[model samples]
Target: MVSKVKIKINDLYKIFGPKGESHVEKVKSGMGKPELLEKHSHVLGLQNINLDIIEGKIQVIMGLSGSGKSTLIRHINRLIEPTAGQIFIDDTDVLAMSDEELMNFRRFKASMVFQKFALLPHRTVLANTIYGLTMQGLEVKEAEERAAHWLKRVGLEGFEDRYPAQLSGGMQQRVGLARALATDADILLMDEAFSALDPLIRSDMQEILLELQEELHKTIVFITHDLDEALRIGDDIAILRDGRLVQQGSSQDIVLNPADDYVGDFIKDINRARVLTLGTLPLKKASTKGIALSNNTSLENAMKALVDAKKDSVIVVKGDKKLGSVSMHDIVHAATRSSETAGEAVTYR
Candidate 1:
């Protein structure tokens, strides 16, 4: 049977240090849990990570440098085996695959783009795009034709002959993206692939990734430290800290109902208007004689209704049917409570 969840991680652990040692020790020390892990020296790259990457949606694993975002993505593709825990891709335990099985899994199922572009410095863009398929024994002509297709798909229609050294950083990254696409894998793993590009190009790349997803519906696991990027590109987000998952939820849910303080602080300054929607707010009975807002409208937009409708209440409508109303007081309350709840979740982490 096809799996409902494209990726599943449960009680996952990755420790760095001596072989057979726990990494949580190092994790504790760094997080000021030092004397706490006094019994061991291993560093916990990931701790009891429990998450589900829904099929065909961009799931951004977000955190700072040491938060283990990269380590986590690598786990999904089995680039680095988890020290302990279970990782499943389409119902198969990735960690249980033999060497050949793993190789086949990677070639046919997972494709990745990296931060450094990972293009052959000496090869032309077209050659680099076809490199992976060529390794799998595809004929030169077939691979070239496929490469040309992705080149056009990624808007690099005419730059196939240029070498990586000859292209702008943005263009080089596109070549890498095209190469990954050419592999025709079921999943795409991107590790800060746009961080090296200038802001303007990064924004363009973000749009490109979204459009690609719309057409292919390939499951995507993207890593990023930028909150804005996470909010913009992720269908769901899994926030990590101290090498452990802090929280996971839809972008709107995370912004509207943060699981902890670390997440709240991470998103505190975010313009709510850009991150929250009516779905984030609580709905009340409508026919009680009060103003209302569309269920699809954002809380920020609903706030406008509360203000412009000149009433402390607004109705919530689902299509033509009246769902409920949110009073001005509830609006302010939800807003503040959500932030505080996030702050509280931070304490847990």
Candidate 2:
């Protein structure tokens, strides 16, 4: 079944300077970012970006510094107005919202989690979590009940009374997450939300997010510069460079079929075994009596299963229906192939 598109961005353009609108024509007329800056003294932040964000799926926007990744995310909530573009959330025009409508949208329809753990230093954890609910004029008892539930959900049940400075960085970020989740918004805007944590903590946070997503299925827009994180969490990824989109696709698609040399370099050193899945491998009609594996199983896990079971091939199935059989040779070849040669000989469905 095809998922519904929750957010649609069309012809998005952002330019920075006093006369940003004036330079939009030049940018649309084929002026590059460097030339625009050097000649017009205006910075081009984004150029003609078009994307569809699926409902209840995580869409990650990633790139190096100055790639306009953060800028693009902010546009979803209209924190930064575009030079020219249209943003549709559930087919409703976001760019056309009045100030009051936008304020209500931010308060009820979506919530943001920042990288810096933007908690109130003066308020207790419970108070901070209930901040948004209170802003919406919810009753004190109801707000507290909602905040307490989300705090416990994020593993901060016992830390409700502690101030932001009293907790470690990871704990503080958890508070920020709980606060965002407490609002019960349909859309979650995470702007490099876990980029500030240590490696292990970041992994833990990712797991937490995935677990919650399995239950809540909120429409998530996650921003990051780390390719590993993007592949691990994003249902779809959009890569940007110099204020323009480089590529956009699933993790397997990008890993196996990079759009260009720029995207290829980003994924060249990545471990293909972890990113590619059995469902992406070519399906064969030949049947096998080996062990059965789910179609979504990773190549890394499939290899381990094969070695443990002492089998040369395994049957890939979706539920009880068998899709095809994949041999050990095919798995190894797919995982070990160089990224530059990817999607050349192998055809992934």
Candidate 3:
């Protein structure tokens, strides 16, 4: 089934300077970032970015410091206007929205989760979660019910009256998430939402988001600098470098076939076995004796399952139907093969 596109970004460009628009031609004509800054005194934020964000899937945009990942997410809600381009949400041109229309769009169509847990420090957990609904003029009773449901859903059932200072970093982040979800908006824009948490808490938050996605499937555009997080949660990923999209694809595609030396170096140390799924491996005839595994099973978990069953291969299934089989040899080869040498054998479907 072809999923509808929830958001479309076309020829997006953002330059940070007084005369940024004047140099768009120069940048398009092969002017490098350093040269553009040195010669024109303009900083390129994004250059000709065209992407389709499918409905009900997580699209992760990642890069190091000075990359335009953060800038790009803001453009969706017109927090930062683009120098040139169009943003379409469900076919409505966001860039074309009037002041009132844009305000409505931000309040009703989209919700943002910030890295710093942008909860009003003065408001309690329940108040923060109901903030959006209240802003939308929902009845007090109705909004409270909605807020309470999401707070409990995010595991903050009793934290309703606690201030942000009283909760741990993880708990504060949960309030931020609950706020976004409470809005019940169709799109969730998470800007480095989990980056500030401790490692274990960060992992737990990722699991929570994925679990909610299974039931809610809001169109999520998650921003991050961590490659592992991107691979772990993104249904599709777009990598940005110096305002340009270096690569975009499934986690397996980028891991097995990096677009350039820069991307290759970025993923060199990633624990691929933990992120690469069985669906990435080539499908093969199933053997009757092996245990069954899901197509989305991680290579690491699949290996553990294989070892536990005393089997060398496992049949991959999606629901009740068998997709193919994967052997222990394939998992090891896929995880160990150098990106330079990766080809058909290691390439997952």
Report the lDDT tens digits of candidate 1 across residue range 36-85: 24556555677778999889889999998888999989988788877778
Better of 2 and 3 by lDDT: 2
TM-score of each: 0.85, 0.94, 0.90
Cα displacement (Å) at residue 197, model 2: 0.4
Please provide, for model 2 over 1-349, each residue's C-alpha lDDT reduced to its tens digit, 9 standing for 90 to 100: 7899999999999999999999999999999988998999999999999999999999999888889999999999999999999999999999999999999999999899999988999999999999989978899899999999999999998998999999998999999999999889999999999999999999999999999999999999999989999999999999998889989999998998899877887787788999999989987775867889999999999999999999989899999999999899999999888876545543211
C-alpha lDDT of candidate 1 relative to the true structure: 0.82
Which parts of model 2 have CA positions greater than 4 angstroms off?
A: 283-289, 341-349
Higher-TM-score candidate of 2 and 3: 2
lDDT of 3 at 330: 89
Quote the lDDT for 62 in model 1.
94
What TM-score number comes out for model 1?
A: 0.85
How many backbone clashes are present in model 1? 20
* Superposition error at 56 for model 1 (Å): 1.0
Q: Rank the candidates by TM-score, best first.
A: 2, 3, 1
